[model samples]
Structure formats: C-alpha cells, structure tokens
Target: MLIDAIRIYCQKNGIQLSTRDKTLAADFFEHPHDYISDDYFNYKLHSFICRSHAELPEIFIVEEKGNDFLVYERIISDFCCLSQHKQQAPQSFIGKKIIILREQPKTLEAEALYATIKKRISGANLFFLPLVAFSLLLPFYSNLFNSRLVYSSSLTSVLYITIFFIFFALLEAFLKTSVYKTVVRATHDNSIKISKLLMYILTITSDDSAPSTTRAIELSSVSYWKAISSLMVDVALLLVFLICIVLLLGEYSIILFLYYLGFAIFCVYARFQSYESSLKSIAINNDRLIDSISLHNNRQQVRFTNFDTLRHAFYVKSLASEKLSHQLDLHNNRWAEILKLNTFISMVLMYIACYLAINTGSLSIATIIAVMIINSRLSAAMIASVNGCYSVKVNLHQIKASLTKLTQHIVLANANQLHLDKIEQLTLENITIEPHGHATLAGYNANFTRGNVVGVVGKVGVGKSTLLRAIIAQAALPHGAIRYNQVNIHNIDALTFQRQIAYYQPALQFFKGTLRFNFNLYGIHDTGRILAIIKYCCPAMTVDINILDDVDADALNFSAGERQKIIISMLLEKQPSLIILDEPTSFMSDDEGLDFLRHLIAQHHDAIFIIASHNADVNRIATTLINISNTGKHKKIFINTPRPTVPITVKPQGGLAE
Candidate 1:
C-alpha cells in the first residue's frame, strides 16, 4: 500500500517510472564493477527518474554521455525526510531539496608498489651502455693477433673466425638467456601486485601529458652506463694478460694457448656481471617511476563530478597510453625484422676482420684458426644482443598495454573512495534502494526515530545491508530524499555522514589483535561507557582492567563471535546516534546470539536501532518490523508494524515496565 501510494504520488506529479527506470535503479543498487560489466551503467538516467515525487524535481539534473546518461542530484534544502516534505504542484517541485550519495574510487597500495618497481627498471634503458661500449671496442684486443686460434691464411682466416665466433657466441647467448629467465623467476615467484605493473606500464606508454615514462626511459639508459664502464675494466685487463702471454711465448706456442683460455674466462665473467647489474638497475628504476606517476595521478582532477562521468573520464584518460603501446609494438616488430639483416652484417664483419689479420703476417695457421673462431663468436654475440634488446622492447610494450586495461578495470573497483564523516543524525524520504545481494530491507520507508528500536526481517539478499550503505550514501539509490536535520544531507560530505552510524555485521572482519586491543584500539586509558557496553553486550563477561597492561592480549585466542561482540561493544561505547546490527545472531550459537541481542536492546534504548535478521525471537521485541523479499518479478518492501512496544510488569524493587 505504501509503494502504491508512492507510485500514485509520483504519477500525479508527472513522475515517470518506466521499466527502463526500474532497470536503472537496479544498476545503482548492484555493485559498481558488476554494473559496469553488465552494461547497467547505461541506465543512469532511467534510475534518476524513479526517485522523483512532486516535492523535489529541480534539485536534480541529468546529462548525456555517449549512449548513456548521468544524473546529478543536488540537495537544496535541509528537509530531506519524505514524511516531512510538503507537497506542491509537480512544476513547483523543480528546485526542491534533495540529498545525494556519490561514489569515489581509490588506488590500491599493492599496485602502487609494483608500478614503483617497474618504473625504476625500464624508465632509462641503462642496459644498453655495456652493449654499445663492448661492441665498439672488441676488435682492438690482441687475443685476435699473431695466433692460429681463429684464422690461418686470408681464406682460412675467414673460415676459422666464423667457426670460433660461432662457439663463443653460442656460449654467451646461452648464459644471457639463462640469466634473464632466472631474474624473471625470482621477481615473480610469489604473489605479484597487479596494479603496480599496470601503473609503470601505463606511464611509459601514456601520452605527453604523462611525462614520467619518458623520464624513466632516460634514467634507465644512464644507469646502464655504469655497468658498461665496469665491463670495460675487465676487457682492458684481458688485453694486458693476452699481450703478456704472447710476449712470453713468442718462441713457444703453449703461451698462446694459455692466453686464449684466460681470455675466454674473462669475457664470460665480464658479460655475466654486466648483464646482472643492468637488470638490477632496471628493476629499481621501475619502482621509482611508478611512485612518481602515482604522486602525479593523485594531483590530477577529473573534469566531471558525477559518478558516471567520472567513470567515463577514466576510460578517456587511459586511451592515450593504450594507443601509444600499440604503436610502439608495431615499431618494435619492424626493428626485430631489421635486426635479422644486422645479424648477417655482423657475421660478414667478423670474416673480414679475421682475413685482414691473417694477411698481416701476425697470425700463423694456429693463431689464424683461433682468431677466426673468436671472430665468429663475436658476430653471434652481436646478433644475440640485438635479439635481447628487441625482446626487452616487446616485453615493455606488452606490460604497458596490459597495465592500462587492467588499471582501467580493477583499480576503480577496489580503491578507497569512502568518506569518513561523523554523522549525528540521518533522515530518509520515500527513498528506496533496491535489494542486491543480502540486503536486509528492500522497499520499506521509515525513519529511525532517535532512541527507538527498528527490526528488519527478510529472505536472504533482500537488501537489508543495502539500506545501511544507502543511509551512509556509499551505494547508489533512488525513490527518496534523505536528510540529516534541516540540512539536505546530500550536500554534506559523505565521509562525515558515514562516521555517524556505527555498525556491526555478522561478517565483521577481525584483524590480528587481542580482545582488549581490538576493543580499545591502543587508546590511552579506558572509559566508563566501554565498561558498561561490555557488561551489557557480553553475558557472564566483565571488562578486564589488566588487559591494557597485558603483553599477549592480541593473539588468536577468541572465537569469531566473541571477537564480533568486542567490536560491537566498542561501537556501542562510542554511543553513535544510529546503530545497525546485521545478523548479530547468525554468527553465534542460538542462545548466545539471542542473549546478545536482548542485552543490546536493553542497553542501547536511547540510540536509534535497526536490527537486520530473520529470527522470530528478535522480531518479537522490535518496535518496527520491515519485511524485505522479492516475489519473483521485483523486490517488494513493506512495514509490517510501527510503534510497537511490549508491556512489562514491575515488582517492588526490581521490575520490568509493563
């Protein structure tokens, strides 16, 4: 009957509650991520229309975005409760008062860590300094001179250089590949923070507006210069060792053999050290880059203030980076194709170097053979290095692309957008937030009179908890205005509003702590109110005075429900104006839950109470019974009783009020 009356009132006021509107209303009630995936966000306009009655119209406005619409409902008056609203002509309701609950998305901490690490590593391209330096100087070393190790005659020198270079190239190529795989395995062996990876990737590929990626690349390139410098030290040392051996064995050929062996070992160690150092620098750089990007991200403002527009804006912000990565991949692939030609050129150069040295009379058949082999090895190493460079480029490109999409999808859902305002009071108009998963109250519209008990009963998922979040303005809703006192609460900061109503749900999460620490929160000293709440809420329980001083109070010693009660006691002691107890009985043994409920009711008589449960025992003591259930087609909510109070008999000294 109330819903019908509300519908009639809306119709008389020219309010249009179409099926589209209902679908849209449902969207607001559903989880944001779920709504986005199911395309329910497309119904924002329809949902806005369902909330209008004759009294308030002008306070809310709607705007279009692509195929969807966004509704911005403003609160112009302090009177947001439906019962208190004065009715007028539909047209006169244009700019009436209303309250709005907005949604904000926050960034995850884990993701921030990942992005920081990525930026530290990839932002500069430091890995290349060693490669370029070694490549340019390898030809001057005497290991290639006067020895039959890589060449003999001009033609034989070419063959021998090719053979020796192939072997050296194969060994280095194998070792570099092994090192890369090892690093990848170590860094990602455990739980990886997905958000950080995306952050670093997005910054690298994002447009000019995001310059961190460019900065990161520069830093990365310079850092590798240090690795390259160290490799040069080893190279210079090997040249001296080779020259000494050759001078000593000028008459005996064995000195040449010893020099070649020592040279190979030095080359391997130098490359290994350089590669590892470069990789470490890259990882560190990635972390710093992510941190810088995050700081900048926080400073930027969204153009649209509405939730729908804000969500759309996120997609727009991500587009530039996504496209940039795609273009980079195309460029990298082209480079990969060109490197195939570079490989051949490197091989040709190796042969020429060996032939020239053999003809100079400094290399005999053995020395020429050794020189040719070393030249072939150098050629292969150059090709492998080129391949690794392209590989790094591709990995970076993909990481950025994947990160943009991932951040666009995941971060918006998990970030901390909830405000923490302390609310002194709350008022609900004809406001109805539809039931989603496990909502306690579906359609009932009633005020939580200060210091009164309101009990709610419904089937599972009837929107009981939805009502709580709605009153707090965390979830989306329609069909009513909610106010705190004369102020249309929609205008008030939401975080402050949420802090007013203290809640204890059955699924209340417990962190690692002692019962006393959980209740007191490391607060200095204790209060009488805290002691009183524990006395009333916990049967056969007393506040432990020594718990404050106990060293082992925060260990895992209590039952789940016991911990819940402690949280409840803490909230009750604070004496919030509005209190919500969701399924307080569900978590405990039947008797324990019942005992707790009774105690809560008796103790909190002066606070507005909303008990959400299906237990008949609880409903018997309620002043109001709200039924929330879905009869197949849609959700239906009704107030079963109002202003109900049981009479109690009084004895001479100790008695119940009858």
Candidate 2:
C-alpha cells in the first residue's frame, strides 16, 4: 500500500524511482517540504538513483529544489561528437516519455553485499577481548622470579610459577585456536564472496568498466586474509612488559630494541616489494595462458597460421615466464635474508645491551639473563608482524578498489516471488549486433507478438545466435535498442524482465542422469507430463526396458533426435512467455523437426517463438520469417500459416515495469 502510494507520487512528477530509490523517496515523503529544500540529502538521493539506474538507457530529471539546472547538464563540447552520437546526454530529451521506477529498499555497496558475513565474523572475534586481559596479567605470574620478593621457600615459588604457566598456556591455546579458525573461515568466505560478485559484475554488463586490478584483488584475497588473522596482541603485550623491565635495567636496552624494530620494518617493506612484483607476474601469466588457449583454437586464422607469429608469441610468453621466475626467486632470497639477518641482529643487539648494563652496574647478571630470554621472543613476534603486513598489503589494496567499483553498480534483487507480466509485443529497432569489432548482423527490425512464430533463417556466422542473445537482453546493444510492450528492456526491473523469456542454444549439456531426473529441471516432479510427451513424440520406437531407472546409462541411451525432443519437452513444459531457440534440431531431419515445431507452435499459442534454423520448411509453418544478411540486405518472407487472432495487452505485475 505504501509502495503504491509512493509510485503514484513518482509517476506524477517524472522521476524514475529505481530498485533502491523507494527508500530515499519514503524518507523524503516523511517531510516533503523540508526535503525539497534540504540540499545535501537531495544530492545524495539523486546520486544514488543515477548510479544504480545507470545500466538503464534513460536519464532521470529529479525535480528537486536545489541544483535542478546542474543535474542533467553534462556538456559535451565537441560538435562533431554530438552530431555522430545523437544519444549523448540531456540534449536529446525530445519525444521520450518519463516513467518513475520504484523498487524494494536495498544496500548499495560491496560491504553491503557481504554485510551478514562481516557482522558474524566481527561478533565471533569479540571472544579475543579476554586474551588481551590475560596478556596484561602475564607479568604478575612471572613475578615469582623477583629475588627481592619474600617467599616461604624457593620450592614454593617454583611450584607457584609452574602452576600459573600451565594455566596461561592452556588459555593461550584456546584463544589461538578460536582466532585462527575464525580467520581462515573469514578468508575463504571473503574470497568466495568477492570472486562471485566481481565475476557477476564483469559478466552481466558490457561497458568495459571492470578493471584488471579488480580481478587481481579478489584472486589472492584468501592469502591476505590468512596472513592478517594471526593474533599479535599477546605478542605486543610481551613486548610492552619487556620494555618496562629493561627500562629499569638500563636505557641502552631500549635503544637496542628500537634499532631491532626499525630493521624489521625495513625488511618487511623490501619483502613486500618482491611480493607485489610476483603478484603482477602471476596474473599476467594466467591471462596469457587463457589467451593462448583461444589462440590455439583459432590457430588456422591468418595471423596465427604464420610460423613466425607462432614463434614470436611463444617467445614473448617464455620471456615473461622467465621474469616471473626471477621475481619469485628474489622473493625467496629476501625471505631468507630476513630470517638470518634478524637472528644475527638479535644476538648482537642483546650482547651490546647486556654488556652496557653490566659495565655501568645498571642491572645484575640474573636480570640480564631474564632480559635475554625476553629479547628472543620479542624479535620473533616482530618478524611475524612483518610477514603479516606483507600479505595484507597485497590483498587490501585490490579489495578496496573492487569495493569502490561495486558500490557504483548496486542493483540488489533480493525479493521473493516475483511475477512476470505477459508481454504483448517484442520490438527491435535497427539492432546491429557485432561481437569483437566484426560486423555480424545489422539493422534487424521486427515485431514479435504472441501466437506468431517468427522463423529466423540465416547462413552460418550471420549473427542469428547474436540476434537471439540481444533480443533476450543478454548482450549490450550499443548501436540500436530493443523494447518489450513498447518499454525499453533496460527501463524494466532486470530480474523480472529476465523471467519473462528463455533462450535455448543448440549446444546444451545435459546432466548424466535418468530421463525423470533430467526432465524435472525446475525440481517440479511431473511424471505424467513426462510420460505423455514421450508417448506423443516417440510412441512407435519402444525400447523393451525400464526408463524409470535413475542411472546414467538410461539417460544417455537416447539418440540425438530423441535428446532434442527431451530438451524441447523440458523447455516447453516450463511455459515461458518468449522462447528463442538457436538451431534446436540441427541434428534432426528438416521434415521430422517440422512436425515437432508445428505441434509446439500450435499447442503453445500464448508464447511467442523465434527459431533460427536453416530449414525452409520452418518458413511455411511460421507466421513471420526473418532472413538475415550481413551487408544490410533484407529478404521477403513466405509466411503460409496464419497466427491465432488473440488480442494482446501489457499488465502491471510489480511496482516497476516487468
């Protein structure tokens, strides 16, 4: 009820209230007059709407009091640029109707995406608070060594020290295990979350917006997590105690500790230098390997076919690999340097501090021996901290960069039970789809209505599959546009828009399972429908064996035509509004395929069919035929079969356009 009222308010004013805009609108509606003049809040709301809805091909004119003139006024000064690309910004606000889109409230950030995991991880680490307190009490337990302190007997003091040592050790073990496990879980969890989110952002949109740095960041995030999770608080507490006691011994001990720490920091920085180089090298090699696989697949191509080109490519790859190996070796050398240098430096520094203390009568021999033991542990902790910093540095930079990009495209579709409205007509206007800078299909204009089966006939590489992909809003259309029910696909809720249509490619990989297991794709068990489809399609060809068996052999026993029937049966069973099949029965004969196609088209008159096939028989059984050409040539269609005379209408099923 609140969303409907808000939607009415938005429609009256020409604002496109997107998936995240409803929350801001509601906040604004609380005190409408106050928010109208509240410049900062209005600015934030405007920015959010613009960013989240940037994927859509519409500009928003948020009619607020402050900065209305400056909102859509991004000036493109180049006259030639403006003329060639007429769709350039606020100037082309001609005959376009503005509809305000509204959606459920959602958090718009990378951190917001992982908010639940982060909160749980943070809460779990709260148990480490007692560890810090325990570290503070460590000195009290070690105080039995103080000769000046009066005790009943030396044996009694030894017993007290041993009992306390055992207690703290057990406590330390418990705290360490808890922290370590939490750290590892957090690392892996962060890795998986970032990998999926980053890949999603890359795969869905085609703006070349995702950077290589974003990939590098998510790739090695787990290692960085592991490195940082090691607890250093207890080690820090020990250092603090050592410093306090040594200060009483002599100031020279303090100087020695500071010197040792400075050297460790330098070693850590140098170690990180090698790590940074190695990371880049590893990433580059991985990219090259993927590229090489593609190159090998297309080895017969003009450039790749040349012997010289092949040799040069291999030479370049090998050269890069050599450099990577060299960097890795350098990293190893630096690690060894730190290990040996720290130990040698620790001994020297301890010797000098002790020598100075004894010569100046600042501390007794027994106190110096205790200080020696403390120095070793202190040095070890410093080295561990150094290593931890190196690992964190590599991952933290990329994580922040990825977060920044994800924050920009924050479309969160978390609503359950989304219903799709019936699409009356799907239209494409001058849609030219060219992948990888090569022209495939050009100027594809058509209208698809329910009950009308449009057969797309084209030669190989004529962009039939590309056109199918573009129609379903799967590929980004930079040249032309597509609309469903006269509304641009991008203007609708992305999740709901996707639900209305289904595209089935010819190269389908069916899971090796029983016919019953494979057919129930939506996890909806309908044994009766499966049996009926088999009976209608393949009644005569009866195998005198059981098909209900849930074995891999039973599923793979079906012939190519039989498998196609099964796939078609499964897709048709789902009853999607629009179905685009790219050569669904390429392996089957044209006559046999026509029988199935005709039956499917006639049976499901409510759903529109767009089949791309080479069969001429398809044209006779379809309402409209699309003959594709790459050189901007169009062919006439021979449509013999008339479509059902069903009136079409666009119904609203959600707050925004479906």
TM-score of each: 0.41, 0.64
- State the weakest 10-residue window (summed lDDT) of model 2: 38-47
Question: Which lDDT tens digits does candidate 2 get at residues 1-658?
Answer: 3334334444443333444433545655443433332111121221122221111222233333342211121222211111123333433333332223333323435565433322323245445555655553444444435543344466776777677777887888888787768766655545554554466565443324354545655654655545544534434644665665467456886766587667766876777777767667765675576667667757668464677877798788878888888878877887888778778877787888778887899866556555655666666666667766766665565565445554564454443433346677888898776644455567667888888888887778877887888787665665788887887776665444544566778777565576655655432244555667776666666643357444663434667787777677666665567888888778789888888888888778898898998777888877888776666544445679987587555657634332
lDDT of 2: 0.59
**Total backbone clashes of model 1?**
87
TM-score of structure candidate 2: 0.64
